[model samples]
Target: MIKVIIIGSGNVAQHLIAAFQDSQNLGSEIELVQVFSRQTTNLSHLLDYDKITDDWNTLAEADLYIIAVSDDAIADVSSQLPFKNRLVVHTSGSVSLNALDDNNRKGVFYPLQTFSKNKAVDFKTIPICLESENATDFQLLDKVAKAISDKVSAINSEQRKALHVAAVFVNNFVNHLYEIGSEICQEHQVPFEILKPLIAETADKIMVLTPEEAQTGPAKRNDTATIEAHEAFLSNENYLTIYKTLTQSIQHNGKKL
Candidate 1:
């Protein structure tokens, strides 16, 4: 079995711990040897107390060490590792492969999806982006990625950076819009639940149709009257700015905003 150790107990780290444990339960050739977290309470529910470590000196040897901490902490965490030459990787979409300390073999095992501690995700459907300096380490990363996900891709630093930007647009930014819509609904005494179907259908349509082909709105029709009404109705300057910006982009046929 390929022995693995994970560092951190944040959202990404917890999700990874669950996915790896699930894979092991299914008889996959992978074993989660241990996990390192500053506060054991954060992960005590997910893993046995014996398997979670708070001290760096007690870290066991493993074939792979996954640093799933925040982006800023990756280098510091890597530098503090007790071992060397092991395949050490970070679960960051924007951070470079070289962010890890030079004492270890660096790689990236970035899962391209937003993670929330309360939200369960199917790793099988999430795309895992792998990057490494050498072919041998990349092969190992690929195997580990495929062990959990059906969609695995060899993404280099530059491409991964671009993908992260696009992900922010599609996932993070879009979610903000949803939050705005929800707030608007609540403010107007409209049930936010009523918009759930529309949201579902909009998301489902993109699965088979191109985003451009699926696009529909007053903006798409260049309905200036509706656009003006929406802009006028939105008393919040931030909302009004975003509405006008998006409308202009749509009317301009996907012009960069």
Candidate 2:
């Protein structure tokens, strides 16, 4: 059996734990030996055969150690490990595999999806990015990744970093726009719930349509009158500035299409 151990107990840790529990590909062949974290409260909801610990010594018994801690803590947490034979991996997109010491075999198993502790995540649909120093390690990583997801890819460290940046652009920045939209709705006395359908449709259309093709708004239509009207409605200087900049960007980019 491939004895697996998980480090840290944050949002990503919950998702990883659920995936490891639901993994049918490995069946009984793989076992989740233990979970390590500073707090035992995070593991309270988890009720099964596995053990939880605040100590790092438990890592010595596992075959694979997965560091699911924050990006900044990854290197610090990894450097404290006492084992060498176990394959040590991190589930971070922004961090590099070399963050772990060269004394142990290292790899990355980054899941390309946002994880929230309160919001449930669909593990099977999320893409898993796998990378390792050698073919054998990569195969092992691939096996673990594929067991939880069908969308597994062999990405190098640089590509993974690039993807993480792109993800921030698409998910984080876009979500900020949604927050702004909600605030605008509040100020205008417009129902924020009314934007839900449009939001859902915007995401749905992208599944079968390119973002460029699906782009539609005053900017896309070059409706300067509507744009100016919206800008006039925005009392906030920053919002107006963003609206003008984005409109200009869209207009300039739209001409290429």
Query: How much lDDT does each candidate structure score?
Result: 0.92, 0.86
Writing each residue's lDDT as its tens digit, candidate 2 over 1-257 gives 67788898898987888888788344845667788889878788973534788877654476678899999998888888886656899999989999987768999989999987788877989999998888988887777777788899999999998999999988998999999999999998999999999999999999999989899999999998899899889999988988998999999998876
Candidate 1 TM-score to native = 0.96
Clashing pairs in 2: none
Write model 1 residue lDDT over 58-164, tens digit each, in one string.
99889899999999999999999987788999999989998889999999999999888778999999999998889999988888888899999999999999999
- Model 2 spans with C-alpha error above 4 angstroms: 24-28, 48-50
Best by TM-score: 1
Question: Model 1, poorest ten-residue lDDT window?
Answer: 248-257
